[model samples]
Target: MGPVAALSALGDRTFGSLRRHRNYRLFFAGSGISFIGTWMQQIAAYWLILELTNSPVAVGALALVQTLPVTLFALVGGSIADRVDLRKMVIACETTMGIQAALLCFLALSGVIAPWQLYVLGLAQGVAVALNAPARHTLVFQIVGRDDLTNAIALSASLGTTARILGPAAGGIVVAAFGPGVAFGLNAVSYAIVIAAILAIRLAPRPQRTAPLPGILGSVGQTFRYAVSTRRVAVTFFTLILVSTFSFNFDVLLPLVARLTLDSGAQTFGLIASVFGAGALTGSLVLATVGRTRMLLVLVGALGFGALQLLLARQDSLPAVCGLLYLIGIFYIIWGSSSLATLQLAAPEHLRGRAASLYFFGFMGGAPLGGLIAGSLTAHGGTRLAFTVAGAMAILIAGVGSIVLLLGRSARARRPRTARESAGV
Candidate 1:
């Protein structure tokens, strides 16, 4: 069959599962709005930082403030999600995000915005996100039953990719038309729409829960132990880290490409980011239609992503980089959505929040470390060298991760050695 015919058939099969569920539709709409605001703030923040410092290192530091909180506090956030009504938790988190954007707008509009001010607000928002991330995923299962869990995950992935395409482009226009502050203010308003959606959702009754009283240190230890104890879970966590460290830093690196390499203005930079978003959008759609829940696809996507990063590193032309970035986005989304679907499905209902916490901890928290490393390395060695290093890191990690997964499978397949143990097994 032709590609279009194949796509049509795939959609016909996959979408039926999604359309049957009303709660999934509501969840999808709310997530889309929230994600759009998220992307808008991200673009505005990066542009503001670049404009203020004109230093790649400073830009990385700004990115750090946005993600470091996740690395530190996500475990506690997961515990909160498990203990609380996750829907209400999302509302509270959204409120915090709205307040953050409002603060950013105030600083920008008042003409009192400093680089340090952005840094502080970014850190504050990051704290809110750390609290929200686990709540967000755990709530997804409530919206769509386990029967459609993989599809819901893919659907959520599509929303992220769609927001990525639209948010940066709109943010650039707003920034160009008025200022960075205007974009931030607009993002704050977008949160109201998400808040309304959350309040409107008719949710299923919650399962029994114990009051989780793990202090920060205890939470961290439990999260770490949980991740270490489960093989599939541990691999999933490590894979997210590998991807974040190598592939996800591309957005943070784009301003460097726009100013130093392409000699493009903010508009061009936004377009470059949008290209990657477009690629991710395509990937998410494909994954949604195909709905692969196996490990094989994840492995392929990881390797494909690493190769795409190397291709991006080799290209200096704006259009070439755009194409490469798109490819990178595509692979990243495919790997991420598939892995998340499997991990979530495998996790026990009781441990879902902790499981998701580990995933976000790897994906979000690892990003700043990657951004810092990429930006600082680029500042000293030049953009090309930085790209080379990033690409190399991705390729290495993908290779290592793939080998580990395969060896793990092989080990699992081996026969029992002890006669008494074998009899019991």
Candidate 2:
């Protein structure tokens, strides 16, 4: 096939889910555009923090604020998702986030944006995110249902990865030429688009919550019990906890890579970050086409992702590192999409929101500790050392997850055999 033919085929494959599901199509289309704007703000926010403080630790603190709320409130949010209309919750959260972005824009444009002010906005953003993410994830299930769960997640994951490509690449230029204010303003407007999309989504009537609502803490405890009891769910969450804490602080690593490692500027950071996204988008599309949530893929992808990050840490040249990042991005998305799909499929319908919120809890909870580790190590030994440690932790967790998977497989194998033996006797 020629280049144009290949491009057309790619588009068809990547968007197959959208073609099949109307509600999901609307949700994905609007969310996709908004995701780009969110990333634009994300990259610019990191850069802005670095500019104000010139400290890696300060940037890490920014990550802390961005994540800590999710870590703290994701369960409550998840609990809320179980009790409410996901569409309305998502709409409210998006509105709140948009207002927060507008405030940031004003702060930047007025030339009075302090590091504390940025941090405060981040805390607000985090709360909305904590509340927003689980409902948003569960809403996809409401749109597409369980049979398409993995495929839907792959496509959904693509929104963020693809945004990584356009958002940061454009953000770099906008921030470099104009300022972070303009990017923030664009992000604010982007949220309005998502809100409109949410309004347009026509979901099947959700199951009535006939049981009295559990206390938020009680609901969270129930989700935890469910997660740990199901073998696949258990393994998936453990792997997320382990790898996410160490290997997933790209926000911390990327800025340091540009400033400290490459001795470069915003454009370089933006470009390389987009390169990473290109690799990630490639992986997301590949997984979506395959349409399987095999545990084998998740385990193997995690192992490879870590090893590649280790390789990435060793590179000094921008060209070489960019190449490594591209490969790492591929592994990263494959692992993430597979894990998320598995969790969604494994959870019972009523508990889906809590399950997803717990997933984010594990996913982002490590940011505080991970950010500190990245900062302290980068401050002393540089990005190389921080990444090396991050990579090693990922590998260690992958190994543990693999053991759990194999043992589960072996146990499953023995069960039917034992039953057959009794029948034979």
Candidate 3:
């Protein structure tokens, strides 16, 4: 079935606090614009790096500049989220990202952009996300209320996927028709939409909690313990790490595939990425209709994504990759949204912000390491080898992880009844 048809069927059953919320609609709309712009800049930035450096290591380094900061600081961001007004924190971070995007655009337009400059700017953007992502997630429950947490997250995921589809396509067109600077400039302006969304909300005051620790390491350790103690939260984070390792490489790999394999240009690379977003959009629609509490959806998505990656790796044809990426995108959205929903449902109300922050910490923060390793492998071994290795590893990891989860469930099921336990060990 088509996306709209599938979504319509899925939307028949609604649950949670989000079903009737007006403010959530506004927030969802604005977040969509912002997400689209962010994706646009991302596609443009990767293409720009490829154009400037012509080296895989340089491209990987640039990607590293964008993700390394998050790995280092997202837990701290989570702590900030719990202590401060998350809405205000998100606005501040979005503002910083806007400025960073503007600066990159100006530098590129003025013919003064260099490899080092890109890395520097990328680092600044990474810092923005380190602060923004956790706060943004934490604020969603505030806007929609705890009852609608699952729906709110699903809607946001759909919007994000929609943006993913639009941004790369638009960025590709802009880069081909104008240049990277124009794409960056548009991304800068896009942040205004998100800022306005944050301003428009009138949320109940969030609970104020004491800051957890003095330094970054201490805070992270605390957050880590909390996540592992929560079954769904821990499972979701590891799932994201694996999925990202296998699938997140698409954007990183696209430039190479375009220039070398497809004999294409910036526009072609952007189109391929956009196709992935399109798939994600489809996945998101499926999620939106599927209702809440579907934990098994994530496992299904993981296996599906592994299969898609395997298909992409075996084929040398760009068209084949495009089709496979769409499927990959769909599964990715399912995996991501399902996991986030589960985590939000499973977390203690008081610790939701911290839990969400730790989630982003592992997911987005781990991207750099995964990208770096994938890029290095690809550089030495070529695209097929890189995809082959990554795809195989992802499939194996997912299979093992799923089996373990199942076995654990079975073990728990076999435990003696509570009444029997009271009687004897």
Candidate 4:
């Protein structure tokens, strides 16, 4: 094929999910716009906390508050998602989040914003996220069906990655030129756009469950039992917990790395974040086009991610840090996307919501502890030490996981042949 044709073919393959489904298209466009604002708010909030308290521990504390709800309520949210209309649930959650953003904007603009208020708002936002996440995840399959689910997931992730690229760069400029309040206001507006898009989407009605839904606590317990009943799902969940708890404290680490380690300001931090986003976006696009998911990729990606983190810890120059971050982003997304895809694909349709909730429970539930450790280490030992500890732990986990996976493969290879194979008909 000619170069132009090749490019056209790649686009078609990469965006097949969007073209095939109008609902997913609306979701993609709306989320693409809103995620930028969400990322802007994240940058602004992190910076604001650091400026207000001038302490890394405060940032860690904020992180804890922001994630605590997810840790506590995600399973319940999953239960609700399985029982309710996912579309309506997501709309409600998004609306609540928008209102929360408006409140943040009001506080920032009124000059009455305080660390305590941020904490309160963070808690509120966390509630919305906890409830919203499972429904939102389940909604993807509802929109795109099983055949296109992986492509849709990757594309959706790319939207977030794209937002990360534009949002942080723009957030830096916005925070520097105007203020965080304006950024918060913009985030509120972005939420409205997503809400509208959600309203426009029309999904096929979910088939009714043969059995009535159980009580919330019973439902949560049943989901937990189901998730751990399988070896692969259990391993995936365990690995996720380890990585998320030890290695995924970038929100705390990056700002400190920028301010204290590099002696830079918001602009440099923004640049680094944007570069990381660029690499993640590239990875997402690759995954979207390839449309292949495998367990080996997850394992190898974990190893690569840990090695990159170690390398990133040692870099002193801004350019070098940005480069390492780019590489880190690539491996991180590979590991993350592959792991999530595995879970989604393996899960039964009825159990998918709960499985996804379990995934997030491991993913987000550990953040509070990770934030605390990262913040404390950075405050006491320095950014290098924090990164060193995180990198080392990640390497240890990945190494152990690799050995287990390899051994399993070897044992399977050595198993006796079936009777049909032995007969060689």
Candidate 5:
């Protein structure tokens, strides 16, 4: 095939899910715009924190404030998703988030913004995230059904990756030219677009609860039991805990890496994030096309994710750091998308909402502590020490996982053959 033909073919494969599913297409297109604004706000928020406090610990504290709500409330949110009106829940939560964004913008514009207020607003936004995650994630399964679910999910991730690529770069420029408050205002408006899209969606109705509904706590308990019993999910969740706690502190670490280590500002910070997002976007597209859910490949990608970061710790220049970040982002998405699909696939449809929430439970659970660790390391030692510890921990967790899986395969391989196989036809 010619080069242009190859590009077209790749595009077709990458977006196959959108072509097949109308509802997902709407979700993807609308969410795509909002995601860009989300990324922009993320970049601006991190920059603002740094400017106000000039303390690395405060940056990590910001992560803690946002994620602690997820840890505390996500399980309950998942239970509500399984039983309630998902579309309505999502709309309500998103509106709350938009209001929080508007408040932040007002504070910033008025010259009264402080770290404490930022933390308080972030806590409110985090509650919305806690409520929103399960409903929003599970809603996709209803839209596209099981067979096409992974592809749709991967495509959604690709959308987020694309937003990441655009958002930070734009945010960096905006912050430099305008200010962080303006970026926050843009985010507030972006939520309306997504809300309109959600209102446009029509889902196939599901059966009403025919029996007495289980208590919310009971339903959540059931999900916990199911996940622990499912070996693949258990392992994957463990890995997420490890990686999320350590390797995923980029928002906390990167600003310091840019301002202190690289002697740069918002543009460079945005560039660093955008470059990683580009590589992550590539990885998401590849996964959307292939849509693999095998456990082995997930571990391999995670190990590579960790290994690349080990190399990242040694780099001091922009080119070198960005290059390493790009590769790490590829492995990051590969591991992330594969494992997420695997966990969702493992659950029965009724329990899928809670299962999805459990995924984030592991995914975002340790992040608060991890942010603190990253911040402390950077404050005391430097970015080098922070990256070194994160990289090493990821390597350790993924490496152990790989070794256990291989040994299990080997043990099964050595077991006695079946009578039919021993007799040989």
Candidate 6:
């Protein structure tokens, strides 16, 4: 083929997942639209809290309330996903989210919204997310099948990153022009689009399970045990816990970095965030084209993420900070997408929901504690010190994980063969 044709073919293969699947296309379009609003709401909410309280700790506390439900109930969500119709579950969750967003809009527009009220609304939103996340993730597998799972996941991440790029900038404009109330109202409308798309797509019928389902507590325990039984899953979960807890408090970190460190405001914060999203979008596209996941990618991504954070901590200029955040975003997506793909691929079909939930628990469950630590550190020591601590923790976790992985590989290579191998059959 000619050069142009070769390039065109490559592009087709890179995006084949979206082109081949009708349901996924609808999902992609719907989710893309909705996520833009979601991120807008996120930026507005963070800024709103900061405007109201002018305290990083208060921001962290809000984050804690938002994520604590995931920590406590995500396993149950997983259990429910395994037993229920995921389509119905997701629709219900989206509707609930819409209601919550409407309530926030009403509160904000009425001029009676308080910090405590934001917390209550945040908690409500968190519950919907906790219930929805597992089903939403597992639904990708059903839509695209295992062959395209990696690409679908990468595309989905790319869509979300794209939304991040657009949403924050739009949010900055909306907040500056109208108010956070308008942003909340936009988010409320976004959910309707997602619901409409969900209603339009027809899912394949699921096979009924003959075995009895476990109770919620039992289900939670079973997932925990299953995760620990596999070395790779265990290691992935452990690394994620460390990274998510220490490193992924960007909502709390970025605004403070803009205001306190860079001496900037909402627009600057949005710009920095959009730059990071741009980098993440680039990374996700790369993954989508690669069409596969690798644990090595996850490990290297974590290491690079830590190194960039270290560099970010030392930088003072806005340009320098933006540059570092861009690099951080790329590595962050690599780490996150690869880790999730790895865990999902390792899980059996029946356990996939539970496994995904475990992954979410590790990734988001620690946010409460992480937010508290970050807020406290930022309050007491400053943003630089907080970044320093987060970077160091990530590096330490990655370093230890690398050693463990290497030793495990070495031990396996040196071990004696099984009886079947020795029998030469």
Per-residue lDDT of 237-258 in model 2, one digit per residue for the tens?
A: 8898778988888988898999
Model 3: CA > 4 A from native: 1-19, 208-218, 417-425
Query: What lDDT score is found at residue 405 in candidate 5?
Result: 66
Off by over 4 Å in 2: 1-14, 415-425
**Model 1: C-alpha RMSD to truth?**
3.2
Model 5 ranges with Cα > 4 A deviation: 1-10, 208-213, 410-425
How well does candidate 5 score on lDDT at residue 262? 92
Off by over 4 Å in 4: 413-425
Deviation from native of the Cα of residue 213 in model 4, angstroms: 2.5
Position 131, candidate 2: lDDT = 97
TM-score against native, each model = 0.92, 0.94, 0.91, 0.95, 0.94, 0.97
Ranking by TM-score: 6, 4, 2, 5, 1, 3
**Which is the better candidate, 1 or 3, if ranked by lDDT?**
1
Candidate lDDT scores, in order, read 0.80, 0.88, 0.77, 0.86, 0.86, 0.89
Summing lDDT over every window of 10 consecutive residues in candidate 5, give the lowest-scoring window.
416-425
Question: Which regions in candidate 6 have their CA more than 4 angstroms from the true location?
Answer: 417-425
Model 6: per-residue Cα lDDT over 1-425, one tens digit each: 99999998889877888999999999999999999999989888999999999999998998999999999888889889988998999999999999988999999999999999999999999999998999998888888988999999899999999998999999888888889999999999999999999888888887677788788889888889877865577778888878999988998898899889998888888889898999899889889999898878888888888888888888889999988988888888898998888888887777778878987898899999999999999999889889998888888888888888888778767998668445421
Pick by lDDT: which candidate is best?
Answer: 6
lDDT of 5 by residue, 59-173 (tens): 9999999999998888888889989888999999989989998998999999999999999999998889998988898999888888787788788887888888899999999
Per-residue CA lDDT of model 4 for 1-425, tens digit only, reads 99999999999989999989999989989988889999888888999999999999999999999999999999899989998888889989988889888998898889889999999999999999999988898899888888888788889888888888999999888888887898899999999999999999987789878877789999899878876765566667777889989998988888888899999999888888999899889888888898877777777777888888888878889989999899888877888887788787777777878877887887898999999999999888888888888888888888887777677557757998667435421
Please say which candidate is ahead in TM-score: 5 or 6: 6
Off by over 4 Å in 1: 1-9, 210-219, 416-425
